[model samples]
Target chain A: MKLQKPNDVMLQVSMRVITLFIFAFSFYLFLAGHNNPGGGFIGGLMTASAILVLYLAFDMKTITKAIPFSFTTMIGVGLLIAVATGIMSMLFGYPFLTHFFDYFLFPLFGEVELTTALFFDLGVYLVVVGAAMTIILAIAEDDK
Target chain B: MSNLVILPIIIPFIIGAVLIIFAKHHRLQRVISGFTAVGMLILTIYLAFLVYQDGNIVLEASNWPAPFGIVLVADMLATLMLLLTSIISTACLFFAFQTVSSDREKFYFYPFFFFLIVGVNGAFLTGDIFNLFVFFEVMLLSSYALIVHGGTKYQLRESFKYVIINVFASALFVVAVAWLYSVTGTLNMAHISQRVAELEQTGVINVIAILFFIVFASKGALFPLYFWLPRSYYGPPAAIAALFGGLLTKVGIYAIIRVFTLIFYHEPTFTHKGIIVTIAGFTMVLGVLGAVSQFDFKRILSYHIISQVGYMVMGLGIFTPLAVAGAVYYIVHHMIVKTALFLFAGATERITGTTDLRKMGGLIKTHPVLAWLFFISAISLAGIPPFSGFFSKFPIILAGFQEGQHVISGIALLVGLLTLFSMMKIFSYAFWGKQKHTSEQAKTPIGKLLLPIVPLVALTIILGIAAEPIFQYSLLVSEQIMDPSIYIESVLKE
Candidate 1:
């Protein structure tokens, strides 16, 4: 039976397997961004690409039903997170966006290095995802 | 060193983001936005006072040193801009709260409004040229959203043109910034000023200066490049129109003044006297002519915004302490008076359901307050004596004649007469003709609508009456800005 003829059955099955791997890789990219080439913006794009693949494999209706959240509000939440991170520095009597870092011992991870830049990066990551998804989805769903 | 400089930018940014959550909740959005506006007003007033008393207040972002990391500088000029921004924005917010439909307000209007404020204030305060571009993007982004908020066919069409023009201008702005950076080997404006002074503005520098002028002129609605302004400004809601009319072009003029004075001052004969003044003359004459031809109230006000911008740049073109001071005073006066006139246009449109002056008549009999208030503001804008416009124009024209720039000065006076003529035409057509509206249409309650505009009208009158002190304050600001060393020292100081 040639499953690759016209319908998206095989493509859909493959996307299901590929989607999980993409999510893991994107998160890895986000985490490794502290010292490497990967960062929030690129990682967020990667995640958005994975989501785009899901929308491609399935129709918009199915994918949106599975993930029922407004991308516009997601952008707002992301921006709030980002601004709050900057204001945190202000609350600590430092200048705006003045990030600080220290290493603390953990049970299994030992003395893991952590920094405020990571949180800032997280906000950027969320915003990029939200923005990218919003634009892509809006264009795809446009009736005109 | 102070952290106060970024507060204006940050507060709006935070509130803008916060307001996005409550987009559907109209009353809450208005309440929060109103409080933010008032808070910003008080903060800027205090900040302006502080900057006036103490020299410049510089904020090094994230504990970064000056000339390396980004810095926000609140000098007298920046603070004065911030003060005007807060005042205009506060009034615009209340006007929007009263006049804007809930449908449009629900479409993330308050968020973008606050973001526009963030961008304007940020543009005023940033010490780095690149940061200025970022803030410009922020401003243009929000303005794009606000312009097309209602998604009308006309709004979409006009705003598309608006967005394209601004985007092209922004691309040129980026190129100019990159070119300036490569030549000076610095992105910090003060450092660029220092390097420019070192190089003494050679031929290459003059080219870059003209390129910068073209970019900013497009944004500020200068002659030959202001084709995209009037129609686009005529599309949006009057509250948004008033805000854009009052504030947006001034940001462009502010950038022009900042760069021309600080970085490009060494070759004023080539750049300022030769190029800017020539452009300013044409901008004034052509812009006023466009106003004369327009029969729509909003269209007239929109074209007038372009003409008034020419005056501000003309002040800068003269490059004297008093002339630049006149420009500053004119910026404030034009901002207040222009916003009020736009609101009056909105008031009449609300009462009559049309902006066509030919369709509107006998507003003087019905809406007496709006008619008289608009008349006062219109005459003030026409450079009538004992109003803000006369004082602001007097110094610039005086400086022009003193500097032997009789041609451009004469052009300015002619434009002023045409301005008065067109204004009187608006008065006659809209207020003195046959009463076209039904008596019930005339009874449309504009008392509450007029509330937000009263302050601005009063400001125009007060600015006129208190021109001496206001002119002196602007003189202080102009002296601080004209002398580049003060700004350079403040920003680059360890």
Candidate 2:
């Protein structure tokens, strides 16, 4: 079934602004996961919900044209990133999932703490978004 | 090195994730999955050899010391299980290549297959209890997809029940783990064992023991909880069925053995002898009865899984060194032979386009190779001499009598006879009757299919022929596991 729909001016206009904040908040949550309660899982869900709002305000065809990525490939990339973070340790003769961290000075900012776990969390965030959207779209689908 | 212990889980985990990106490229998926399976088989064999040489290989995940972080421990028993998982999964993976439909393959069958392996290997190798639960979920989630891959009306219907039952079990698992944590204050299995030793198998511990048993028994297809095995296993395509039959329930059995031996050892008469013995007797009798009552080829084999599981747990129930060794031996034998039988069922189903015993016959005249290979598997399953099953079962029954548990041992022996009867029933109905299929159907080529299964059949025979050394190896393993202190020390010693 084609996902054609008439535009709703208010949903479209309101979501265009609201979705950006949601995306920003999700990014904050995803980054904050390392030391705080907010981490990749919830972050990914936040991002997904933001995208979901976009899909809700726009037609699926339009949404597809705007955000063009297969949900499965997103999940795959996410898993690969998360697992690779752990696997990188083994290459250095450390046990699996042995994370590493260091404080590096930035040009724009003071010293910033960098860690492999952040990448791992990023992977989790992506997977959560991919999985949630995939489930929703699968259910929301019109009969073929 | 400790790093090697982590490879089995990582290999599958990485390959599974990679396969997802190429889901639509079925040929690439097959090539990559095929190579990964063979690579895993080699890696596990080498890992097992390392463990044999030096003892337990422990990888403290994230370099955290035991009691604080996740750990993967490859002891003799775990390494043996990894070896078996690699063998059966390698066979099933190849068999699946030929048998599973392209539509199903397109739906990410190969990725889920490796993820299932990730879960299985992780479950066997993890030294942390919570991680065990995590691995169980990974395995079950993939299975839920694989089971319902075809999306046939029957598959969807049956898998709903399967998913529900397992979800409920996983919930109870967390509950059991929580209660365990509350009592022991630890999530690391070795630490839990250390803590449980101090707590003793008293009132709450015994309750938790039984609760843990229930969680695992549901997964393992034991006794009263086995109602879902036959129907749900019947719904999937045969290769998935073969994989599930060969590896999944064995994980449950492995957990039972691990938990009972390590953490719940106090008051053996209560937990091991009294409760486990009675359950084993019932599981064996009722399971074979279910098999004997079934006429469909796959259903019979599915029900047989329950009965054979009873034998594995029976060894644990007996709780002697010999008995536990027999249990270990039984597990290895069953994983190989069961896969062979299921693949045979799959092979025959492909030719006749049906699994009902009454609907298939005279394959022996047309497919002699399939006929005899299946016969070896069937008899090995029945405990016939000079086969792996006989050697494996002999020690368990012998130990049972020596322990003077005559009634349960008698039940075990009687179940073996009934198992033979059911297998022969399958044989006579499916292979020996007048020709049932048309000439073209009868002549359908199964050589490629049979090629993948050959290794499984050969392993069962090799396991039998090499029973002397293999049984000795299992005895060593049983010795290693029967005393929990060895594990606790290996994990806790910095």
Candidate 3:
């Protein structure tokens, strides 16, 4: 299961444009996650897809070596973060999975404020990326 | 309160993480897993009794406010499922102790098993739909590994299909969650119910409900989506088979019950009361036919898992408290007896080296203990008189009649009789006829190998003898589920 060769020039150019658009959209989604529609899940998927396209186009062996950490551990860490965000409520005298309060502020860039839900969404983003990558890569390795 | 919500998942998860480092040492891994399983059982039972006294325990993770943060709520339904999972996990682990080879056990099986329990428990307890999807992936990924643990040609081939289908289902799950969030603007289950109630029953919600149903239907192995269970289950050893048989489908059932009764109750005319009954009846009839067609001992049991799920779902479709309570009670009884029955198949297979009923005979004379235990569970599975299965079904059928669903009632009755016939076929072919095996092999007897099934066998009888209190408890669970305002208020209350 060697990685498929990189897509030719036309395909690569189209993929690059798509990747850039996704990155910008994903950032917007993550920034507007709280009180608005988008969040970390969409953002994470966008980022992961961008990475995945590159990996699939370039060699997987190169992609595998380029990564700095294990996808499975990233999943574990993501889940732990998600779970930990929920656990933080208990420390402040709430029940399991109770979220702390939040505040909203509109800034020059956009509305910006800290919310535990943002943390939860981030955790979700990580899990989605970790799980997708793990399954895809594991299947690829198995084929090999 | 936290103990009630998080302990069940946390202990198994911590132990599972630790086992990864010790995966090479079979003996050490077994000892740790054994201790963890026993701990989980004790914790689950104590928690069940706690819920019995104090009502449901809703733990908001990290003490966040409700409707804003995720919650892990333990109502009677969650605790009951947890108790059954712990029981099945313990029994299956013991059976695995005797049967699974050291080489296979050493390959991170114990850790993966623990992780699987974490996913199962999380799925039952989660208060958010998206979080449920996360837990589900956690569970299924581990299952993918465990199912093909040894990487046999058959295991790999079948599990690949299983993995691909579930992956696709999970993608649909995300899609559904995204759509739901767009419509309701909330992911908290209780909050979704509250919001959906204020809005009109739009066509969009109906489409979303069907989408959610499709995802769970595939998971639960409902009428049109059940082809994956039988073949994929055949890949694992008996112990894992028993675990999957007992708990996995129930998770799907739990999700169905939770969503339909809580969030989707806003439009029962289109969603809950109508679709559930229609699909459930078909699920029961078709599943039994599949069972009747199969000759393999394990295959028959696997098919019956689908059929029995129908009865539980039928109770839900009835929409009356009596019927729903019956479904809850039926779930408890079925999970226990079904796991025991599968373990018995595993033992018989261990002794005879074949699951094909045509390949062996007359086990009652040589291994009377195994035969009798199998007999009790089989009879219970068939819903015979004096067994918990019958008691559970009686209320369901009575509730069905009371609700004027005579056709469904009639189908359920016919399914019950066919279930009895399928179980009897196994009893006669594998236990009652002439001894076809060599004398030396017969002397080894399946009796010693069958000891792990003793506790579950005893549990079936106990459930039968103490049917009154348990049935009353089921009534309470159904009442709680039906009037979920209490659940929502507690979770969302400031």
Candidate 4:
């Protein structure tokens, strides 16, 4: 199905920024997700939407060249990262996925605790972005 | 310990990606994959023992503790399914080498095959329900590619419906998970079980349980939800079709058994014996009728997938240790035998160049090995004695009798008879009639193909001959599921 409306550079640029904003906001939400309201899934979808913005502005071949083979590989990497976080606790003699860590002083920031759960959430975020990109790109290419 | 729990899932992910780089070298790709599959088979056996020795082991992602982090648990059930999945995957991959056109192997087939295994193993091991949905999508996505790999018009048309229906089901799965999360506030199965037990209400829990049932039922191809299955499955090559026939829907049934028995047991009012048993009876009857009416060999086996699922669900719905044992036993036996039968269908397709029963015949005289193997699996599927199928079905039916559900027992017996009739129809039409294929078609060697089937046939025999120990183990698994307080306590820590 061809788009009925012609593309405008200004409109496309605005869509791009909106998509980028959603992606950034989603990442912020994901980082705060464990204790606050947002999560890995919502954050991942936001990242995917950013790519969607690019696809809309340009044809698929350009988008494909821009991304290269990273999306597929990143999917594997993200899943491995998620699994690695689970295995980390086993190495520490905790039961599977046992979250343990401590608060520490930082250079730019005062004090905060870093937990394994955040790492797992980040893994989830990466996988979501990669998988969503793969799907959108594959479908878009098929359309072209 | 974590190696046993996580390696099988990880190995496939690694191998699948590696295969992508070797896309230009078809022979090298096939050889490397074959080695990896053998390695996986060994890993699966070793893992099964590790689980057997250590009991259920949980791996929490990113060191996040329960109720917070995603966890993967390898219990008796998970390991058993893993073992079965590896066996079926190895067989199907070898079968694919013989059948999958050279063009496809060079394409995305090998990578997706590994991806499919990654998804299956992930689904089996996942402790979080939401993670289960994610893995389910992974598996379904891979299957969508494999089904339409050949890109024939027939395949494209059918797979389009298949993809749309599954996409809809996946969306529904997310919606159901959202509802479930809202209700329980925890995605961990063990935590959900504990919380659900505290609030024991038939009103809302029942709604959530039924919502879950809807999601799995569609995926598992139960009764009214099975329309897309036969049409779409018939389009794939025999090997891929056999793999889907054996493994895909069973994963759905596995999830249902895991969730309903463990987490959602609070409300018998909605999911209890009444609702499930009714569905089981209808699923069995309708499935067999569909099989009886089909003139094609693959189509018959596809319908029988629904029928066999009914038996497993009946065991669950009965909600007794014996019945659940029967269900567990039935799942193992069906996985092996069903894959074998489907492969045999593929073999016949290779020899005769058709899957239509009417166009096939007299394989018994020419290829007695194929005939006998089909006979073993078919008769077993029909619930014949000493063939593993009988042992699996016998307990469930006996459990029905013991539970005083004589009516269901009778219906089950009737379904068994119809199953036998349908199998015999395939035998007589496809393998027993006068030779129907032309001379050129008959020249194809059935022996090379039989290599993939020999292990499954041996397993069916071994399972039957050693039914006592296997039956006892299944009983043990059933005991754990029925009382699941232990599972809950173990995961959640009293």
Candidate 5:
């Protein structure tokens, strides 16, 4: 089950670059999710893949040094954030997970609309990323 | 007030997340989880009281209208089940505190336990079918983790089967939900019921109903589908096995009762009488036979869970108010007693260091207290007089006779007799005869373990002595369920 490393240096460099691009695109998907197609689940998977690419390009030891925090903590935080948004709505005398949206006008930007659901989606994104990484890392480590 | 309905589901979810962070601090994790379980129990009891007084309480999630958004409903049955779930889970948690290894504790057992609760409560409370599927996944995912927590070879092998079977059932559940949605165009239960009533018993509707039954019955471990239960359950620690024995299949039973009564009642003769009654009869007969053949402590009890579930479904099959009431009563009684019995098994295992009845003996001489406690629960499980099991079973059998289902009632009585024989087999072999392993056995103090079992044993007795009020409550619950109009109007407001 040893991971086969590519001999070519160009492959590793290109993988790193592609990983960054996917990470940024996932963020874009997550932010535009409330009004558009992409949301937390897909965005989170994209981010996890970026990390996965890093794991693929680098050795397990180097990747562990790069990401020091426990992946499970990300899951816990993501779940807390998602549940907190629901509880926040409950605190405002609304049902759980009831989203509220409002638009504000700014001098620099024309207008921006914010929704509580976006934060909920962010929480979902983090959980997906964390859960995916946990499984992948565990499997990869087990192979070693 | 309606918001209270969602608290049972949410409180656990929040606690589970928090416990994940404190996973390394075992003592702190125990304290936090203990307080949360107690708090949730109190909250569930209060909610049950409110529902008992004020009829059904429905909370539309995110302020979505009834049919348009997800809702959590706490009617008599749901709240009743919620109360029972909280009681058993709390007991199991405390029992785990005494018995679960520190290694498992550090591996996030408490978090997964709470998550399992979140899933169970969510399954009982959700008003939408799709939400039920989601909650089932949550429960199954945590169960998959918990069942294999120790990662023993036996645990790994058995849990793999358990996971595969449940995953298949879950997929079938989603397919059933999708088919029903395609047919009825609504996911909300009450709305679907209304549509089902309007559509009458079309062949497509009946097919969908049968599909749903197969999905839940597999989860509930009915007859042929119960192959995964005994071996899989035998692999986990007794505390986990107890929790699964007590609550997991009952969730499936709860779903069956909810859907059959609310949405698929139009053709009782075929679905309830023909199909369910037949399954109930076989489930009882085969389950008891399996139990009678088992030579291990937990394996026998695991088989008995399937057997006892047959009685509950038989009550539903009888399809009378008294019968359904009896089924409800049986659920409450069975959950408490079965969990207590398993906890007792765990305590005995701790002392003797084995689950094999052949290798274990003289527990009655060594630990008279544990022996007596097991005796009481065993007899109660066997439907002996002056215990909760007898009273709960009495109504179902009586109702079966009254309804002229003589053969099914006769089968129920016969199964009860076999159940007694098997329990006594366990008693004599494990507790009574010569001290088979007395020289090798350690006299581990079980005071902490006994703490959880005592309340459950007491509750079983109280449920028996105070059967009048409990019976009346079950009747009220049955009436509300038997007549779906109340549930529909309360939820949909049309």
Candidate 6:
């Protein structure tokens, strides 16, 4: 059986543009996650969906070149970072995952509070992206 | 000091994550995972000793005290389980080093292995009921992956059933937890126990109790729910099968013991005596009958797992301090002996190239050491005198007879005979009959495999000889478990 590819140039180009916008919005969600409803899980998922859209629009060779880092490494690093953040609390005689925050005036931005939870969120984001992408890519590759 | 309670869980999670990075380096992965397993064993032993000397240790995660946050608790029972888990995991990991294929190794097997440990240890130690469900998911997911590690046709097919059944049970688990929280307004196990004691056991609560029982019974492979065990367990390699046989179902039994003794004890007559005792009898008889009918070595062991589970539940059903102590002792004995038996079966399969009893014979002539070790474990499993099984079963049956539950006691005795009959059938057919395999095949080296089985066999013998002291310890554990006030006070103290 032959696989069908989307032949419409307009649909392909529009998907590419929409994928970029979704990627940007996902980053926005991740950045504002600590103070709002959006966080690592949803953001990472959005990022994966954007990549999926690219895969749908383009060929496997093109997308493989675009994402060079291995998914396994992403998952490993994400988990390590998350666990390390929790262990860091133990170093200060606090229980695991005890987050600390402090507010400081930035040069350009008005004020920013750096919280350990953001790093934890970042770890979750990476893991979500890595796991979802790995699964999607494997299934797609198997289908081909 | 209370922080020590979390180490068993954290160490594994960290090691598993790090192992994922070295997935391609088999030698590096083995060294790091080996070191981690031994380190965990040492830490678990120290934790058990601390609990023995100093009493329960409770750590509220992120300093959020008692009912409000996740907590890890290391009482005697929890520490004992942690110690046993580390022991079996270390043994199984070493065995896997020899047996598991290189492909499986490179596929993040070790990471999933440690992750499974994290789940088991977390389930054992968690003070909150909801976190227990979360830990169960962690364990189940890892298990689902590991069961299909090689992804053979048989593995993929059987693991589908295993996964589907467990997913259903997991959904039921969530519903049970939701109902319990709604009624008590607390997810912390210690807090819930306090609430349940105050309210006493109502009919609605009893319904919830049975619901929880059903969830755990499926996981524990009790009667009517054990249809998945024999077939699914047959697909994995021997090392993995041994680990699952030894540790997984026992977790379900541990949960049942913990919840029933601590939170749902107000109506023991209806729940424990009436329902549990009857189930215990049927589980024993049915399991042994299944074992007696199996012609394969691994399948026989699988069926025996169900039968042995019935004995432990019977001890719990009897519900005396002495009887619960016997159940505790039985768990320790069974975990060691069952893993040893499975390891022996693996060693035999390595030599004979088959698990069928009819196709294998006269192994004792060629591998006397392996055969003897298997013999010891077999007798111990069958409740023979002067072995670990006898001492464990003695108190439970004695307690049954003393309480005037003569029929259940008689059933226990009958099941013991049937268990011996099946075990002897394996011994005579596989070890003592005429040689069926070629001499070349029988000469296969099994030294590496026997290395793990020997320690477990020795432990069973030691447990039998030193039964008095161990029984005393179990008695103490039972006493602590029977009284919920002490557990609540220890966890909720301001």
**C-alpha lDDT of all candidate models, in order:** 0.91, 0.93, 0.86, 0.86, 0.93, 0.91
Q: Please write out the lDDT profile of model 3 over residues B375-401, one tens digit for every residue.
A: 999999898878899889999999999
Give the chain B TM-score for each candidate.
Answer: 0.99, 0.99, 0.98, 0.98, 0.99, 0.99
Runs with alpha carbons beyond 4 Å of true place in candidate 2: A1-7
Enumerate the candidates' DockQ scores in order.
0.71, 0.78, 0.26, 0.23, 0.74, 0.67
How high is the TM-score of chain A in model 5? 0.91
**Tens-digit lDDT string for candidate 6 (A79-118):** 9888888889888898877889999899999799889998
- Where does model 2 sit among the CAPRI classes? medium
Cα lDDT tens digits for candidate 3, A1-144: 777655477766687688788778887888788778888887788878877887766667767887877776666567667777756775665565566555566677464467787777887888778878877787777764
Candidate achieving higher lDDT, 5 or 6: 5
| Ten residues in sequence with the least summed lDDT for candidate 4 chain B | B1-10
Instruction: Provide the TM-score for each candidate, comma-separated.
Output: 0.97, 0.98, 0.82, 0.86, 0.98, 0.98
Q: Model 4, range B62-153, lDDT digits (tens) per residue?
A: 55676787877888888899999999999999999989988988876898999999999999998899999999998999999999997999
Which model is ahead, 2 or 6, in terms of lDDT?
A: 2
In terms of lDDT, model 4 sits at 0.86
Model 4, position B199, has a per-residue lDDT of: 79
In model 5, where do residues sit more than 4 Å from their true spots? Answer: A1-8, B439-442
> What TM-score is obtained by chain A of candidate 1?
0.90
Q: Per-residue lDDT tens digits of candidate 2, residues B376-404?
A: 99999999988999999999999999999
Error of 4 at B94 (Å): 1.0
Chain A vs. native, model 6, TM-score:
0.90
Question: lDDT tens string, model 6, B266-295?
Answer: 898999998888888888899999999999
Q: CA lDDT of A4 in candidate 6?
A: 77
Relative to the unseen true structure, what is the C-alpha lDDT of residue B332 in candidate 3, on a scale of 0 to 100? Answer: 92
State in Å the error of residue A103, model 5: 1.2
Docking class of 5: medium
Candidate 3 or 1, higher TM-score: 1
* lDDT against true structure, model 3: 0.86
In candidate 4, stretches whose alpha carbon ends up further than 4 angstroms from where it belongs are A1-144, B1-3, B266-270
